[model samples]
Target: MVLKTAIFFVISIAAFAVMFTTMAPLTGFLSYHDVPRIVKDNNEETNWFALTESLLWDIFLVLLFIVQHSMMATPTWRGLIYNLGLVVVERSFYIAATAWALQYIMQSWLVIPDYPLWIIDTSQSTPWWWFFTLIHVMAWIIIYGATFTMDLPELLGLKQCLYRDTAWEFALICTICLTARFTNKGIQ
Candidate 1:
């Protein structure tokens, strides 16, 4: 029991690390991952077939992540984990799985042909760059702040595995960690 908890605690922490690492650019670290080409000025040379395939591939990646994320949260899934006597590490496993899904998407998501729907031209000398950077920094600060409002360690399975909690605490911990995820619990 101790070993399982210890291992999962490490796994969950690693998962969170990967999540932060990849999410920064995709959700927060834009255009950093390895792609031969990024958003070009225009995509007049795009091939229809190749573009279609890439778009479909991106859609599939997103859908697969959604399915895995949604499936794990269902009561039936929880019951299976409980029956398997894996409740102690369920949250950790879920976090790990979530990380895996995000990692896959982040690594595989195709950069579609650039349409440049709307171009915001803030030259290097302009303060708009700093303004936008400041806004992005502020946004991330608020996100992290909101995350701390909830028991992040417990949600990540650190406290749960480290300390013995009563049934009520366990049940609450089983719910997906809030912050933008929770309709009623987030900044709603």
Candidate 2:
């Protein structure tokens, strides 16, 4: 039991690390040197094969991610894991696999030159831009905050090992608080 809990905790932390690394660009909080930004200036010069090969590799990564994620969600896969005595860390395994796939995609993403999609010039210092940026950041904050209202341990596959039945009551209270907080934010 101790080993299971420790493994789950470590995997959960790793999952969060990967998730935050992927999401930090959207929140303007991370500027990792090796991590590719989802939205970047398309004027930089890149190797021709880099674009094509990277794009193909990215597609393959996405397919792998989809297969791993969907397959693990199926009953048959769960049964297999159960039969294999990996039921306890099944969700953690899924999370870690998905995170690895995502990290691969992010790391290998190609920056296409001369292919501007949507470039918001932050240098202009427009009030509306800042306002919308604030709203965007707040929206993400609210979304993450709302997750506290749910069965997070179960969602993370730690429910059976770490959480008690009473946690549901706390979840419900958090839901009410989330709703109130959102309502208050919306009003202001």
Tell me the TM-score of each prediction against the true structure: 0.70, 0.60
Per-residue accuracy of model 1 over 94-137 as CA lDDT, tens digit each: 88788778778777877663543355544543677667667767
Each model's lDDT: 0.69, 0.64
- The candidate scoring highest on lDDT is 1
Q: What is the C-alpha RMSD of each candidate to the true structure, in Å?
A: 7.0, 10.1
Steric clash pairs (candidate 2): none
Q: After superposition, which runs of candidate 1 have C-alpha atoms over 4 Å from their true positions?
A: 1-46, 123-125, 165-188
Quality of model 2 by C-alpha lDDT: 0.64
- Estimate candidate 1's RMSD in Å: 7.0
Q: Which ten residues in a row have the lowest lDDT in candidate 1?
A: 28-37
lDDT of 2 by residue, 1-188 (tens): 66756765676666656655665643443222222335435685665676678678767867887887898789998999879866656776776677676666666655553344445555455775677677776777898889889987666666643542446458668889888878956743
